[model samples]
Target: MPRVLHTAQALVDVILEIDELPPRGGNANARSERWYAGGAVTTLIAAARTGAEAVHGGAHGTGPHGDLIREALARDGVILSDEIRPDVDTGYCTVLLEPSAERTFLTVYGAERQITAESLATLAPQPGDLVCISGYSLFEPTRDPLLEFLETLPEGVDVVLDPGDPFADFPRELQRRVLARTTVWTSNADEARALTDLDDLEDTPEAIRRRLAPGAAVVVRDGDRGCLVFHHGRGTQIPAFPQKAVDTNGAGDTHTGVMLAERALGADWESAATRANAAAGIAVTRHGTESAPTRAEVDEFLA
Candidate 1:
């Protein structure tokens, strides 16, 4: 079976439940606070729960934060590549959750951003594997090494690119290089629009497809309205199972992870996307960054 390999950062998420965003000069009080393993960990955990063999190939620190990330990954059966950085601690993201279930973030980088060709060599991606990457990895220190490693992927390996909220801000040249190797492009509707520069939401998927490698697939996820899955000159809308969302931090990652897991498990794009939609629906109804549903839970929800 093809493994779901992640080449992205996993950070500790310090979540604060607050009433609303504070003014620039003001501060808001939090009703509660919690923490969880986030970032790439969300995707890997979702993939692992969906029965895919998940592996994390990013650098981690040799401190408390890294220990937390490692524990969460291990709990979910995700294999961690042996690339622990010495002395420094892993990074963290401070997430503010409002009553609306919307979230704002402030991140602090650490050892995870120090990826290199030597560290990435531990991943040793094999042909037929689905390697997942996030847009965050395109920043400075980490970008060059990751790009270099990507160029050496074995034939038949599938690169799954999840363009996060900041994807539009990445360098144009960097975007081109990554898209040239991306076999699967998964992101939200707004991101799809940004990538294709299309006003019509319906046209962005096809336009985005043109930007990727030939025979690439596109998945445009729209909250409540479901998602668009385009591949092989065909496009289909996979309906979403909407739920009352509480914390939507990891919803998109859950969708992408489940989609890749299903694909690795031999499901067609459409079927995999349908299951992914169900998983994301369940994820939003829960709390925290690791809210993705297990395979049995997803199956029950679909049934």
Candidate 2:
């Protein structure tokens, strides 16, 4: 089976549950608080749970936050690197979850951001591996190193680009460079619209497809409405399996991970996407960043 390799950061997520978000000048009290390994970890856990050999190639620090990340990855069977950043602790994102399951985030940079091409090369990614990249890594200090590392990837290695909410904020040159190397483009509906600069959401997928290299694929995830998948010059709509969402923080990551895992296991694009939709459906119905379902759970849901 093809492996799913991650080049994205895996940070500790601090989740605070609140009745609602505070206004710009106001303060809101959290009803509860918890911490978990998140960021790229969510996707990796999802893939690992879905029977893919998942590897986290990103950097982790030396403190409590890093310890939490390593423990979670190990618990989920995702392979983690032994190298650690001794000088600084791992960073975290403050996640505010509303009663409606909406989430907002504020992040702090740490050792994970201090990446280098030389360090990443240790992963030794080979042909037929699916390497996951996120728009968040396009920032300074890590950006150049990641781009440089991507340039050296061997043929047959698939680059999976998951442009986060800041897709439109990235420099045009950086965007073009990453997209040029990306073989699989997966993102949410708003991010897809931002990428294509289109007012019509219906046309965003095709526009994104045209922007990629020949034979590249695109998946635009629309909440509840399901996902739109474009491959080989054709588009298919995979419907969502509705579920009552309690926490949606990692739903998108769950979808991405399950989809890639299915692909790595020799499933067709449509079949993979359908399972992904089902996985995400199950993910949202639960709490925490590690809420992704296992292969058996996904199969049962689909059945």
Worst 10 residues of 1 by lDDT: 114-123
lDDT (CA) for every model shown? 0.92, 0.91
Which structure among the candidates has the greatest lDDT? 1
Please provide, for model 1 over 75-145, each residue's C-alpha lDDT reduced to its tens digit, 9 standing for 90 to 100.
Answer: 98999886688989999999999989988999999988888877776888888899998888887888899
User: Which ranges of candidate 1 are over 4 A from the true structure?
Assistant: none
lDDT of 2 by residue, 1-303 (tens): 799999889889999999999899999999999998999999999999999999988999999999999999999889875388897999999999999998999999888987888777777888888999999898888899999999999988999999998877888888888888899999999999887889877788889987776789999999999999999988989999989999999999999999999999999999999999999999998889999999999889878
User: If scored against the real structure, what TM-score would every candidate get?
Assistant: 0.98, 0.98
Candidate 2 residue spans exceeding 4 A from truth: none
Cα lDDT over the full model 2: 0.91
